[model samples]
Target: MSKKINEKIQSIIKQCESLSNDDIESLPNYKKFKVFYSKKSHKTCDIYLLCAFIFGLLAIFTTSISYIGIEHVLYYSYDRIFSINIYHEECLAPKLETLIDIFRPITSCDICQHIDHIERISNITREEFEEKYAYTNHPVIITDAMNDWLALENFNYEFFKRIYRTNSSALRGVEDNCQFFPYKNKDEFETLGDVFNMDFDRAHMIDDDYKPWYVGWSNCDYSTAYLLRQYYSRPYFLPERSESSKLDWIFMGTPGFGAHMHIDNVDLPSWQAQVRGRKQWTLRPAPECFHICKELTFIVEPGEIIILNTNVWYHKTSVVSEDEISITIGSEFD
Candidate 1:
């Protein structure tokens, strides 16, 4: 609604005009332009008439499309590191570092700080976040994995013991092994297992009492569901009302288990943070490196965060804890 954004929409419309019909059609809301014709002036002006008619039809069609699309769309001119401050017209990465430092102590919760960087770097207020960044349809960069170590050192292991005493199903964490709590949905769990190239038997092994080195639970909405398990991590925004902002939360079940390389749903970004134990993260840019990245994996330490522009590249992790609890935070962006 701001004048600056209005100009941006106009600029995008101009850019769209230069694109080919095929390209325009590939975008959402432009299918109407593929058809529809307008009236012409003179009978003798056949060629000129058709040109004028089509232009008029396209002009009206594109204008309406632009108006609607800009409401929920964001167009970035750069790739990978988008570190500029479009709002203040200044570089924000440095300020982001300052915020990280300031919140360093308070944010150290064993539930872990996943994607704290994205939250810290996001200087937008809750209102502005709702109005602008939420709807931009851009990937949010979650970072600062290293912040978790602070929380890990402060956690009271005896408190966790109290939880285990009351709830036997509550699994104790191991430092080296990846462990997870399984969900009730078998089919959805299997589907997620397939994404990780695991068979149902191998995946379901987490349900066994043998206590493997690592474990993780999978279901239709594991990420979202996991967040719900904790009372403090309620979502602040939804996709329909406002633009999608990042959803960040701590994952403090066990250690060792990690995600595999894969693209996110059509419009999402993500970052993983480590609060306790350790994880190795391998990152590859979305360029010529895509294929190699898909085949490789990485390890990250307790204090590290992996920034995943889920829209662009693939990543996988390896757990590094020996026999201690591991806590992590996962963040998603729109």
Candidate 2:
């Protein structure tokens, strides 16, 4: 075996030395290997290239399986086992639960002390907030922030119905442009009125035995946007004259039903104000933050504002009381 290996090495060396100096220089780590193998071994190089090609093909195949097929299998399997429709097209991404379980031994770290409670402030200056929290990607709840907003006093189901439903002309462009997301239901509503008219009371009663049913939609219509501005002013904590898109979102539902765990795909941070009832929010750091920080959970009462880096955290919200309907209005900002 020793003699045979020596003969093979000698053959490789001779083959390696036959290549031009320029060609040899082009090869990675060529100078180091040139001391022993002075010739190019086309067979050996072909074998390595073949192995890389196979690996590349395998990577593409695996990704296709994961993205196109695995989600469907997992979705149907989960639905069959639980007898519930918990899967949504928006949530087809690989779950953090699975990733955590697989990588916990390697990724787990000390729970960050700051994760215990989001910073609570009553009268923080915009400069102070932007300096401490906004730029740092920290989450905070500003208590007594929207105390004077008319939305706190007049914004409710009836208020919206009176404003938008009464004037069909105002909703002409917006009624069909927005998409409605229903809690665990696949039904799609074409307009805001259709969503408001959902059998929420009955759904709330039935949700006692099943997962909670919630619904939400974005306020993208020009008339609806104008209507919302009449009741709610921008929170005092946000920077004055900050540029933000006119698109805002409204979430309304009873307790036990709300948004599921997911990160926002927005370009900037966001603030959500609880205009009615109360909401409990459970926020987890993005998978990248797992090694440095732990999850944070808290509640936002009516009239309170929560400013958070929704783009960096996986968060979900649920109403605190079943009796009182929950209404929250949120918008993104720079």
Candidate 3:
């Protein structure tokens, strides 16, 4: 873009143009090689032809250059080389990172110097949990926290099917009010509607020949959320001052399929209750702290709950095996 570079580009463009007869005659070899391209009879026509050829090539060049404007989504993994696209921006103001540093001095690089692993605990009082881990950016799993929830016994594939079928409003709310992540299986199930309308056996997941699918969606309706909450209660360990999210989420899938690694941009920390089957969670630190922190991986068995500050911890999940569908339900609490 400098003047020197612009001049060089113009010079290269001029060199590709056909030379005039007067210009060609100045060369010493003009008499020896009277190029047919320079014949007097076809001189004007050939110039036009050359112009057309150059314009055609330029058209292709411009088209390719314009294509770079399209948005691209990328994915990354810890300890694995993959493309990454982190898009955190504000519409009309500075980025969240800049705005954060404006108010609070960010010296959090040392936040994880002591956080070696996500702890596992049970029967913890709210005060104890808040003193140790609540909003602390440290992750932990409460092993027996969900023991009283009836969701463990009732939240299976058939229960979901029945609820959605009988409660048309809830089904409609899921489609219209929530975002559905079809993950890599968007080819077959473009919408949650299609997922529910599948054949009976496939819906029940009764056969081995069924196609693999993983999906996640939030319950958007108050009625639907209340219905689903009938089986589960707010985690007792949440701090008294903590605020719970209005939206609740469910992620279900077959073995070997789960969420991609990504950081969330949300107001509250999240807690996921592993309801039906076992799931493996892999948590990674922010890119800047990749070396300063360690990547932690663990399993959440049924009746256990895992909580983390997902706004900071890059996390992903996977069903443990082909034996059962992975089911998890949770909401965020600030």
Top candidate (TM-score) = 3
TM-score of 1: 0.32
For model 1, the local distance difference test gives: 0.42
lDDT on C-alpha atoms for all candidate structures: 0.42, 0.71, 0.77
Candidate 3 lDDT, 55-157, residue by residue in tens: 9987865665576432321222211232122232112232344344344423365656577777889989999999888867778999988878999889987
For model 1, residues 1-334, the per-residue Cα lDDT tens digits are 6999999999999997899968866888665543433223244478888899999988875776688564222222111144322332223343343343334332112111121222333233456544644444222332332332434455333433333333233321221122232222222322222223344333234444423233343212344334333522323332344332333334433345554543433345544556567765554433344333233344556645544545444445555665555556555545
How do the candidates rank by lDDT, highest first? Answer: 3, 2, 1
- Ordered by TM-score, highest first, the candidates read 3, 2, 1
For every model in order, what is the number of clashing pairs?
32, 7, 0
Question: After best superposition, candidate 2 residue 203: deviation in angstroms?
Answer: 8.3
Residue 193 lDDT, candidate 2, scale 0-100: 62
* Model 1 CA lDDT for position 290: 36
Q: Which tens-of-lDDT digit does each residue in 1-334 have in candidate 2? A: 9999999999999988898878879988976787556445766788899999999988976777787796665656556554334433334334445554444433222333366678778888888877887656778888988877899888776676565563475444445565456654434443456654556555344555543446677767776688788887877877776655688877887777788886665688888888988999998865655767778778898988888876567789888875767889888888
Which lDDT value does model 1 have at 269?
Answer: 50
Worst 10 residues of 1 by lDDT: 107-116
